[model samples]
Target: MIEHKDYCVPADTWAARVAGGDRRALARVISFLENDDPCGVAALKELYARTGRAHIVGITGPPGAGKSSLADKLIRELRGRGKTVGVVAVDPTSPFSGGAILGDRVRMQGWTGDSGVYIRSMGTRGSLGGLARAAYGTIQLLDAAGFDYVLVETVGVGQSEVDIVRVADTVVVVAVPGLGDDIQVSKAGITEIGDVFAVNKADLPGAERVATELEMMLDLGNHAAWRPPVVLTVAASGKGIPELVQAVGDHFAALVRADQLVKRRLAREKEALLLRLAERVRREILQSWSQEELARLWSDLAARRLDPYTLEERLYSVWKGAKEA
Candidate 1:
């Protein structure tokens, strides 16, 4: 078995190669990182200084919302504008194989030979949010690789998928016509996360109704920055793609004008820093405490010799000490 210590060194080496535009090296680094090897985290930290160059757009929606098709069309449109695009498709993990299905690749296969396009599929990997830690690290890798645009297509929405807003510069929430009831159920979270709303499959019967409902919701909400625009698109037929792209551009421009992009960047940095700190503290605490110590603490709690509040205080002190050391 490969030890974590052995893996960390090569992961940083691979990360350097990836930053130098070595595609095979990038792939290997990403794959290793996906497996949650400790080396992968080390590699990601090494590459962190090179990131934050790319414009990240997150595409999220309920299952069967044609999000993949919409993402494909968006990539094509972006490429047509002479931009290099990186796509990160987040898919559900296979319980049996411990790998992702990568179904989005089937829809985005046209870009296989395009040197300007780098496409990767990520597994949820038990991440509470639609994005895994590896996926976040991969996006940074692509951003550092100098991709002009990065598109993140998430593994549809659940309660946790709302976290996409924290990572994406522009978030496009796609929904189909027949899912109005479902939309209503999830509107609070989705509405707040989306910078732009897309009514995909516009050729369907209830597209207008969906659009109207979204518009009304936006109007009702007190969004001082910009009201999220609801655009209709027939993603399969490639209809309304141009308008959708335009809407995205307009939203990006609005963010820039309002100086929200700077705020967003700062917020993203803060989030990344906090996550890193939390992970480090958690790992150090786990490593420093022996099994006997853990058992003793638990036994004390069970016997009422230690109260929950006091135990929490003691744990905090231990964590602080570990962090300081």
Candidate 2:
């Protein structure tokens, strides 16, 4: 268990190390936080003030959409331009091990020894919205560490992956051929989140068909400040990566011109603040109640003697009492 006295210290030290460009410290801090260590959160809070400096790019799509391959290519392209990159690959949790497999590392070996690039994998941990506070915190750490670009790769299913829109400065939605039904499903989650679309594996027969379908969909959507573009790529062979990178850069530049980035950042800040407040209340306040008190409350609730609103009121009262104590 991490003691309160030791909590702030590791966090502060790790924040400083990240600021100094210590890769290992950055990795360690992220790992610690991914495991929900309290000290890690403290360290993230300490380092949070230093973040919001890097460009955050989120890549998401359906499973087997070749998102990892596309990300690997994007990293290489950014590196070639002399830009330092940080990648956070969010993998699905294995029910048995309860840990991220980091399977995408197979294609990402190109950046293994490159000090200019930092890569880390994260698990969903049952966070429904693809938005893990830990992943967001890791991005902040990389941003504070002075990385030019930070890429967030999320598991390509459910509403959670689409939540990347709230966190990323530029969002890339990847899709593949023969996923006709997928495009429809995507409309519900990711269709609007994209600042750009990537039709990866352009060598495939149905690539053009997929591209045309996506273009038609985008054309039918409500007009925005900037229209999202679709780019084709065979990521394995590095085809069309340059165009993809340029599209990403151009989209970011347009966001700057429209001054929408500021609005997005503000909204993100508000959401993060509320989440932290809720977490604090749940932990320091609600948990202070004795088991007997909780059992009695639940018993009353089960008996329908207490409605949800009343229960919430009681919970808040308990919280207030704990604060006073």
Candidate 3:
């Protein structure tokens, strides 16, 4: 396991600044993490003890589900209750700039000047799971920063979006009306992941039908402990947002009452640990291999003299030997 002392001492100041509500420091740390800097990891380690205070909420669904609109409304609702919010909007990577497309940032301009609200737009960076690769760590940073709520708005990609469940304390799967065939196609993939379902654009023609289908889907599953509530929301009009917020709060309360909160967080930590270990091993292996060795391995593979499976075995053996040493 990596320790705080492994890194230089400067990160201690970054961690303190982040915890003390320095948004600039938090932004810099997020950038460092996005760029894969070791300082970000060190600061995170230093601030790890201060995390878990914020409620991490994931807003995700297929494209055209109005997720960003709903997130904006939710932020407003939470902030009205005097709760500070941190929003991490996962936008599609711009091919030109290699940065966020900035669509969510544009929509969420209302909160830009509010000191209690900090919104960050993160490019998906070709990450397939609707979230940026650095989103989980960024959520922890926001938690450590003392935000009452950390809302993660995903890129609204299809089914593979289940990654949100691993990080969020509450997952709100947003569905909009008028996408009949698309909804049918996504049912098997996304219907099972929601703790709360939001049928946004409630004023649309098929809003009730979408809500009904969601209820039917929920009924098909065994949710004896807590059933996910379907809330009809017109995010643009702020209709039913309070109810949506209540549903999210109810789900969280249910988790706490059932003693599942800590268990879920523990599972998240385990996953993060495993991922970190794998990443470190991969980096170390790559660094240990000389350019000539790498080139020769690639040449051999291309020439059909070495198979990928054998190459994988060889790398594993090297890693095992290094571990023993």
Candidate 4:
């Protein structure tokens, strides 16, 4: 049903197809992106202008916190309200093949027949902070494809995995009962990033205790603009999911009412630009260093002739010189 002959290059054709709501084309481009292929990067560039529409919600928590189930419920809730959804579920990498070890695609298979929903599983690929390197690009592609919402389900590394804050319009920190150190986890930097705290598995005992702890901790911070509400949810049965969805909507509405949406987006854009620049510099430094040069530097370090700081300076100088050249 889709024509591909209009664009000359494969990237152009794929980009055009994606812009036209072709799911297959979008998946193909995302695959190319995950592999760091030039075509994928080119396609993203071509489709960049059409992005920045979808609301990106990030769900993250500790292992066994039911983040996936919460995401599933959120998708159903959103769809019930006539909104289209896209999901990027980040999982740990397979040591041998460097692919996603957890098959989120299989877990989210219920949506396979729904044209309005698209889900993709991504491996962290050794990137830290609970996300794949291609996550931002994948979100952009989904946004360009006209999805109403993009849910980024981070790897359940821990409460410290606040990287989702960098990409999500609303960062929902999922917590469950029986995590003995729930209060400590909240104090450990998650409270600062969370726009909504979801107490999933609310059916479990001590759920009220966990919510109270979160509320008490939030009271200490006294966030003026918007206070992150703690919503109780039993994601497995979809109980309290509607309230969680409403909490997310309220946060977005508050951001818009306060005229902070554009400000947050601007900050996100700046951070993304800086990250790309850093990656480019790192790539250039690695490419500029010859094997012998690297070996000599390692040899110098091993022989105690040079410190890591000095080697880093030398490498920076080389990168700078190459850029100038």
Number of the top TM-score candidate: 4
Candidate 1 vs 4: which has more lDDT: 4
Output the worst ten-in-a-row residue range by lDDT, candidate 1. 92-101
- What's the CA RMSD for each of the models? 3.8, 3.2, 3.3, 4.2
Tens digits of lDDT, candidate 4, 1-325: 1223323266678888999999989888887767666677788878888988999999888776888888888999999999999998765543212234566332665898999999887765544432444777899999999999999887553433336788889999998888796543554578887899998889999888889988988899978889999999998899999999999999999999989998998898788778777867787788897899888889999999999998899899978887788
Q: What is the lDDT for 281 in model 3? A: 83
Q: List the residue pairs that clash in candidate 1.
A: 8-39
lDDT values for all models: 0.77, 0.78, 0.80, 0.81
TM-score of each: 0.84, 0.87, 0.87, 0.89
**Per-residue lDDT tens digits of candidate 1, residues 1-325?**
2355764565567677878777887777677667766666677777878887788898988776888899889888888999988888776543211233565343777777888898887755555332456777788889877898888887555444335676789999888888656554255567777889989989989898888877877777898878888999999988989988888888888989998987997898788668767866666676678989989999999999999999887888987886687
Error (Å) of candidate 2 at residue 196 is 0.7
lDDT of 3 by residue, 1-325 (tens): 5434444367789999999999889988887777666778888889999998999999987776778888889889998999999988765543211234575343676776898999887765544332434677789999999999999876453434336777899999988888885554256556767899999999989889888988887788888778999999998899999999999999999999999999999998898777767767887887778999999999999999999999988978897788789
C-alpha lDDT of candidate 4 relative to the true structure: 0.81
Model 2, range 1-325, lDDT digits (tens) per residue? 3454465575578779888999778877776766666767777777777888788999888777788888888888998999999888766553211233465432566677899998877666555332367777888889989999999887564454336776789999888887775554346655677889999889988998888888988888885789999999999899999999999999999989999888888898788778766766776655777889889888988999889898888788977876687
